[model samples]
Target: MTTHTDFRAFRIHNDAAGYRGGIETMNTAALSAGEVLVKVAYSSVNYKDALAGTGKGKILRQYPLNGGVDASGVVVASTDPKFKEGDPVLCTGSGLSETRDGGYGEYIRLPSTWTIPLPTGLSLRESMILGTAGFTAALALLRMQDNRQTPALGPIAVTGASGGVGMLAIDIFSRAGYAVHAISGKADHFDVLRNLGAVECIDRHQLVFSGKPMDSARFGGALDNVGGAMLAGLLPLIEPYGNVAICGNAGGIAFESTVMPFIIRGASLLGIASAGTARDLRDQVWQHLASDWKPAHLDRIATREVTLEQLPEVFGRMLAGDSFGRTVVRVGKV
Candidate 1:
């Protein structure tokens, strides 16, 4: 493999002015310390990446870092026993864009422990099509299943349904035989949501956001991405003993609600921190993403592809809530 000092990356830096990210030429030697050097073929944009790139949230623990949380590529070099040159692998939520440089570049040097060898059924591009967003969706669904959630319970509600996690959640749950009710503010994408397996697509305002703390349980379970009022509203409507996996807080972080949803209705609120998941569970989740939990419409979910130079506008669009589904970045030749 050719070792080039010249490569491009979308790097973020915080200075006296504030946080900013843009595409720039970089060298392989400038990558953060790790056990494997991957020639990143693809990376996907997630809400966290939007936050980090646009400085809308506290996603980056430090500044002057690359800013993508999901990447899939071929390893070019490795000092770890688990990986070798030419291995197709992927990494997500291993502190990328948080404590270390991430996958926004054509190359990423990652700890081998953070890498998962590409499962038999997925291609390098297919892996990034799923990316961290899809992985989080799968992880949330798996957690719900572990807590005894089943298709027989009732329809599953996915809030923020047009975004990456929500779209993939809708697809995976529907394929798993559950009726999926997608709730989104983007009315224009209702047909797209249905194409991805949403049995019903409800407008964000259609649901009652203000009412009694406890209501008749409407959904068997739910995957909540917009975590402020939307989540507060959904908690009281989950079936008894049903699970609601709390993933993203795209709406707002703080919310107020009574304990009746938990204590009276026997509802369960499960926190999903995809980045901090244990290695074993992470491995299990990725295995499922490569297999059964993989979305049937992976190509459809990856609705857009861009070069690294286009990331700033993409992140801006995400913060404005104008983007939908997944946007994969072609970082390098596969």
Candidate 2:
């Protein structure tokens, strides 16, 4: 069957005219090279998507590309035998929206290496609701566990606890038997955080860190979405041999901290670069998410659902710091 057909995409472009993104008619033939062509059903917005959609951040390595990093849909056609017509699949990171056309379109061509079969427990829609945000959170937990960080060490502190990754992390970590201590500047949302399984909620604005490099151990580890001062402050409070997974740089990139946490206390700071994650590890994380690590509050975590026309408004709100939870984008009918 011929896969070439006209479809709409939230494509981004840059040239002499300057940076911009909006809905435009496109052809499946023009999509970036891949073995699997999917009729996209759902995608989700992340901080990176907002940045890429609005040109606020340099998320795209090349121009004239579709702009959603997370996508799930049914296969329309496939050159690879692993996928066939109407089989559900999903992909996150792995170069979508950066080096290639992404999920914001009604149809997307996905590399076989990155396409994942829809896990048994998740539907195509639920898979995108988790998206890249949830993937990063699960990857952090897996790495922390690999580094020998355990629940017996102490409670895990989740910074930026009101945002997508933070909220999902609370649900995932709690389901895996870790006591989650949520730290957020939005004190008004503490009760909501509790409902997502946070046992303790700390107001970050009122958090006072003694400038000292070493402090009393208050947490076994942390999954920090805010970096800069937040990362600097968290290190000193981890238990011995604890692991801190840094997934986001919402606060700032640079930070000043002493080596006491690493040298004296054996604290490990793990970097969570979800994009470009090796295929094996990516598969491992997805498997766990479909089973034991799946969040119990996925429906609640997906707080907003929008069509492609509403992406600009969603991007504005997210970049303005008004984003609460995950925003699922309904791309096209399956």
Candidate 3:
């Protein structure tokens, strides 16, 4: 094995100079401690990655770490018996770019517990395209279904419809036999959302919710990427026993609501903290993502492919709300 190969990483630092991120030469030996050392093939951009890359949000626990929350690669070395020197694997969340180095580098050392063997039915590139965004969506669905959410109730509403999670949700949920009502601020992109299997496209700007804690049910459930008022508003419109799996907060954090929906309607608000999901649940989510719950429109959803050098521009676009769908990073050979 290469003991100390020279590789490049999109490293972030915060110090006397200030918070910044850029490509830098690094060594495999210098990467954060892990049992598995992988030659990264691909990584994907999530809103969280953008936040970490630009220091726009408090994402990383420590500084001077490589920046990327999702990665797929071929293992080059491992101390763990479960992984070998030539296995394909993928990881999302589990502290990448948070307290440790992440997948923005050509190489990554992953904690064996968090690394998933590339499941049957997904290529490395496809896995990265699904990455963290699709993982969150699938996890939400799993939680929702476990709590009794079903397609028989009504259509599933996917907010932030053009974004990575939302677009994938439309595809996943619709494929799972539920009608999907997509809501997005970007009205012009409604056609694409529809093509991804959204039965109805509701413009976010035009959709209004009654302030009442309980209203006439419109959706069976929802996979909401927008929190704040969007969350508060949707609560009242959910069917009885419907689950709202919230995975993002792009629309501000705080929200005002009442217990009427919970008490009278039995509505559920499932917080999808995907970053630190447990091993068993993570395994379950990945298994589904690689099989039945996989998004059908992965190619359409992966809107851009870029190298490490182009991350800054991508981050800027994501932060400015100009980015839609997933942006895949070709870290090395795919």
Which has the better TM-score: candidate 2, or candidate 3? 2
Q: Stretches of candidate 3 above 4 Å error?
A: none
Q: Give the TM-score of each candidate.
A: 0.96, 0.99, 0.98
Per-candidate local distance difference test: 0.88, 0.96, 0.92
Per-residue lDDT tens digits for candidate 1, residues 1-334, read 6554668899999999777899888898888889999999999988789889988888888878999998999999888978989999999988998998898998999987788899888998888888888888998988999999999889999998998999999988987889999999889999999999999999997666656788888999999998998888898889888899999887799988899988987889999989978889888888887777778998998989998989988988988878888999998996
The digit string of per-residue lDDT tens for model 2 on 1-334 reads 5899999999999889999999999999999999999999999999999999999999999999999999999999999998999999999998999999999999999999999999899988889889999999999999999999899999999999999999999999999999999999999999999999999999999999997999999999999999999999999999999999999898899999999999999999999999989999999999999999999999999999999999999999999999998999999998
How far out, in Å, is residue 139 in model 2?
0.2
- Model 3 alpha-carbon miss at residue 13, Å: 0.6
Output the better candidate (1/3) by lDDT: 3
Using TM-score, give the best candidate's number.
2
